[model samples]
Target chain A: MNIIEVRNLCYAYEDDEPALDNVSLDIAAGKTTAVLGGNGAGKSTLFLNLNGVLTPKSGTMFFEGCQVTYGKKEMLELRRKIGIVFQDPDDQLFSASVTKDISFGLMKLGLTREDIQERVDRVVRQTGIGDLVSKPTHALSFGQKKRVAIAGVLVMQPSVIILDEPTAGLDPQGVSEILHLLQEIKDSMGITVIISTHEIDLVPLYCDDVIVLDKGRVVFSGTPAQLFAEPALLRAHNLRLPRINHLMNILHNKDHLAVDTSASTISTARASIKNLVSAKENI
Target chain B: MSGIDKYAYQSKLARVNAGTKLLFTLASMAVCLSFSSVLVSTLTIAVMSAATLILGGCRLRCYIRLLMIPFAFLVTGTITIIVGRISQPTQALVSIPLLGARYGVSADSLKTGVIIFLRAFGAVTCLYFFSLNTPMNSLLSLLRRKTPGLFVELMELCYRFIFVVWEEAGKIHTAQASRLGYDGFMRSLHSMGDLVTNVFLRVFRRVDRVTAALESRGFEGNFELLAEQEESSRLLEGLAIAATMFLIIIGLLERLLT
Candidate 1:
């Protein structure tokens, strides 16, 4: 089931070119979706529209099958379900203490003190930020700050969380940890996760669905396997194939190995190679 | 600035109620400033510094180092009051002719300068005692209950954004320096102008991004901060009151004696 659906969405700044032009896509329920785009590709604009932070210039958006009204009550309702963690953790963390920052959103919901405490504790534990929660936000490392930012959103119990470049400035270890945390949220909590990132390599490992944007328009939307098969399209949009997938492509196309290039991830490529080698031995 | 914030969060009294600490600080500062007695100011400074270093868990070396920075300025200020154009040479401890004027340190002026210096130092120690013990978020929360909401809101934003802008400025300075932006006088001035302008511009962009992030999390025009969970201890309150009374008694006694 689609949790969010947009039709012919168009958004633009004042007297400027469209930031999002005739964009339309469906974000699947309870699945990880990667929104791939280069700089100025309207990925953030689309996220703002999804969370109802900005009113789209034209076109309609539907969340859970109801049209988004952009009214005060409806907007609040939409925002409660769709949380966006901005690319910069500093932008999101306004409170000094990590616990206070995480609870800011929960407090807005007017939840009971016990309920807010329970949610805050659960999220801090889930994000593995329990020890850091007592520290000041300004004292956190960049990676730690990112985790706190994610915890802040997760505490809100959103049905869908949108992350703009979740792994943009993280080290490899930080990136791996964040992706696994997001994956756990998707599997355990059944929350739909959407991330727009330039980290093409992480898409196959963590994302179930892929949507590509170019010049403020949706260029492609499909499963990760289907998206990677069109290498030319990926190149045109200023994206590169994951290194493992590129190696598999070379083996299939250049080396003429009897293996499917469509198997693009590490696990799948390993399985494909194992099958081909075993088949050869039998022959 | 961020260093002080770090130490504040790590202070042993961080989890205590901010109100008690604030009350003690205000009372101490008032006593320190009102009492012209050098002995009372000395007592105030000793009590506040011991509270900060021993009870507040701030490192002694850092405490002394931070104190020295403002203490140096205080010395410069005291010097102006200590030495002046002398009307009577009889009272002069030392006298010098500078630019056709007789400058001297009088017995009366020395006494006044010493008292004022100690008084200001006592006030500084009291401020350090409070801030090092109370983290800004909890303090802001306390302010919300006592002061105007708008004023507290402004303070909260300013506190958060100051660090953000400081970090951005640091990064911009590094970028400029990598290209030798500060190598020469003329070029350094030009680079500094550019750096300031760029940081000013980035602040606006940063604000828009932060506003969007806040809105996505369902923030309305008003802030909805979580109520701080730190409990005020009756014992701690009693201790603070006792200490303030002690300082007042000492000040009053000194006043009576004189």
Candidate 2:
């Protein structure tokens, strides 16, 4: 069953232009979905709508088969269910200390002190930020701050987690650490994960399903392999296919070679290259 | 360096509670203020300088430098004495003219001026040590704990708003820098006014956003002690309190006897 369903959502800013127009999609339960698009492609707008931070002008959001309407009462419930990790850690972690920021969401839910403590401890431990508990938010490194922001959301134990550009503005080590923690959360906890990002290479590695958005519309929604197969469609949307897919497209269309063009990652591309060489020898 | 950043190669005073240090600082100032004699004020400076140096983990040199701030009054007072009363009492055998007037030198006013300088220096040193030892947030937290509920809430809101103002200032500075606002004096003056106006609007918008964020996070506008009880630190704090009291008592008794 679809854990989240959006039907014909439309949103505009100040009557100037549409930010999201007639966009509809479904997110599967306990699966990872990567919403991929170029800049100003309404991916973040869709995320804001999912979290109810922005209300749609003409569409409905359904969480677990129940339609969500924007009201103070419903927003509270929606906030509890949908955890949003903002692109910038500074926006999310405005608290003075790490401990306070981590427990902010849980505190809002009005959980018992013991429950709050337990959740905070668990998330902090999982995020590997136990040593940063006493440190001020400003004193921490960029990676540490990002982890604290994620811990803040994780402590809430939201049913569906939406992270907008989680890996942006991180060093190599910081990016790897975040990706590892994200994999651990999805695999171990089985929470529905929806990440809106422009990292196409990471999308193929981490996401089970890929949603391509363009100009405030859902242009394509399918598996990464299926989407990568259509290079023309990707370019038409002003988005490039993954590097490996780009190479495979060159081999298939230019070289007139019969080879599988579905590989979306570097390692798989190398293997496909080896297979193509062997297939040529057989021919 | 982190171990003794405030004082040169001394133990840390960062662990001490802000409220306790403030109260002891108040007591030091009160003792110093109640006296008029040079000997008593000198003793007051000695005791505070030592306490701040040892217990507050501040350097003696640093406190002395901070004490120099009150010298503006000292400079004015000294000139007043030299012109208004004394003329070369120690250096000159004859009167000197100031503003086309001759003034007589007095020995008693010289002693009074010395006494005034000492008293001012001692009070300023006490305040300096208090600020150096206690962290800013802890000091604010101490204020929040001691003040009335409504006032504490107002102060806390003010502290939170300071960050909002800082962000606004940062953006304004950036915009001005990009526009070459610092090239000329007139532009700089105009930029300052523009910065202030920008800060006001940013702060206005920030208040609504911050309040919403706080409400969403269930901040009921109260300070609860989230820290666990530190038994050893509490004992040390108590000892520090007693030691300050001891210094004030000994100074008072010595002055009375002398």
Q: CAPRI verdict on model 2? A: incorrect
Expressed as tens digits, the lDDT of each residue in B38-141 for candidate 1 is: 98899899989988998788999989989998899999999999989987888899999888877989999999999999999999999999888888988988
Q: Write the per-residue lDDT of candidate 1 for residues A255-281, one digit (tens) a residue.
A: 999886887778999999999999999
- Residue A114 of model 2 has an lDDT of 78
Docking outcome class, model 1: medium
For each prediction in turn, the share of the native Cα contacts (below 8 Å between chains A and B) that it retains comes to: 0.74, 0.03
Error of 1 at A242 (Å): 2.5
Off by over 4 Å in 2: A112-115, A256-259, A276-283, B1-11, B36-108, B144-181, B187-232
Global lDDT of each candidate? 0.89, 0.72
Give a tens-digit lDDT track for model 2, residues B133-218.
Answer: 66444554566556776775555455444554676598779979898997799999999898888888876766655544443333
